[model samples]
Target: MRFVSFRSGADEARLGVLEESRIHVLHPGSTLLGLLGDDGERLHEAGAAALRDPYDVLDLDETRLLPAVPAPPTVRDFMTFERHVEGTAKLAGPDGRVPAEWYEFPTFYFTNPYAVIGPHDDVPVPPGCTLFDLELEVAAVIGREGRDVRAEDAAGHIAGFCLLNDWSARDLQLTEMQIRLGPAKGKDTSLSLGGVFVTADELAPHRSGTAYDLEMTATINGEVLGTDKWSSMHFSYEEMVAHASRGTVVRPGDVLGSGTSGGGCLAELWGREGFDAHAPLGPGDVVTIAVEGLDSMTSRIVAYSDRGR
Candidate 1:
């Protein structure tokens, strides 16, 4: 089942199950993560009950949606797409090359969960950011707690998936990387996630060998930027989760980003093409991403300014 978190009128953020263009509101003040924290069977029953006798129903377009997990406990973005890594290397300069270790295991970095924002929310362009860019990918939310999980058993711990846009400030990121670290300031400005969460069962039809074979695409200001299939990831979500669990606890509401798919971000495009070939994101640009079953997400670019400015 698909679920969404939204706020309407004077009410606080609330969870709801999506039924077509309408939302069957769940508890009056519950959160999406709170529901995910519950037992799977109980959550299903609650959703079913909500659908049958919704205390409130609202048109999907009428509410302001929040991120799928709203405030995830933690966020880890993995570099699982080999092609994207290779392509981005060219943009990294002459000595740029994909590290051999990347092929050995799925590598990831923790990102600020507080920076998370929903699809329809405006992404603020950080001050001094000139080469603002967007990374289009998929994100999974952890449902059950686990540690030292095996790849074969990791799938059960995932709650759902959603589209993720990892916004970046290329120049800042590049400068930091030159010192052998960081994608931090460049990335922490915002992390856009689709408000709608598609359960694993709902996307089972798109499952391929290890990853889903869903078609993912992104556009800027109505112009198509890139498109790729989720099946291209070298490491599966299961593998990534298993790797993440090595000597560490994976908790419910923690989000796992699939990293940028091949051709999914302008940085990769710049490497494949040339730096001068494309323009960076600027104020007023709208970035929209869509996956086969997960609903689309659109975010407008805005600048940090005074309240009345």
Candidate 2:
């Protein structure tokens, strides 16, 4: 079953499972975060029960979506796609190939959890950003708490999966990372999560090794940017989880992102083609990302008069 965290006409946050035309409300005051604890037993029970016997129902058109895991404890986005890494390596690598050390482990960077936005929300263009871009990816929401986890054991800790958009200020990212310190200011601005939260079991049939057979697609203003299969990723979500949990804890509500796919962004296209194929985004540009069997996410780029919003 798919779930969504939404705000009704009254402006209060509510959790519900998506039915055909309406949202079956969970128990009052229950949240996706709270339900994810205890190895997802709460989530499993809550989702199943809500679907089986809903206590309340809301019209789908009367709700505004919020990030499925509204405020993740931490967002660890991994560069799991080799082709994406290879494309980036054209600049970050000595040759055109990735460094040998890259094979040692799954590499990920911490992104801001507070900046996360719901799918279909407006995305503000960071001040002075010229090369605005969107990264098409999927994120696994960690449900259980565990330290020193093994790759094979990572599944039990995964609560569910959600489509994720890692918005990028390419100019800022390019300049900041030159000092070997950041992708911080460039990345901290916004992260878009799909409105629907798909449970792990839903996608289990498509599992292929550490990867899934899901296809990822991204478009800007209704035009296709590119598409790549999840199977193209070099590292699996489980491997990333194990690497992240080496000595620390993978807590409930933490998000792990499968970084940008090959040709996922215009930056890679420019790198591959040696020319600017698409101009940077501006206000009113609609960016959308879709992953097979999961919800499709959309964000409209906007120029804000008030940054506080």
Q: Best-fitting candidate, measured by lDDT?
A: 1
- Per-model lDDT: 0.86, 0.85
lDDT of 2: 0.85
lDDT string for model 2 (213-275, tens) is 888898999999889998888888889899999989999999999899876887777666553
What is the model-wide C-alpha lDDT for candidate 1?
0.86
Each model's TM-score?
A: 0.96, 0.95
Q: Which residue pairs in candidate 1 have backbone atoms (N, alpha carbon, C) closer than 3 angstroms, thus clashing?
A: none
Worst 10 residues of 1 by lDDT: 300-309
- Superposition error at 293 for model 2 (Å): 0.9
**Candidate 2 error regions (>4 Å):** 91-95, 306-309
Clashing pairs in 2: none
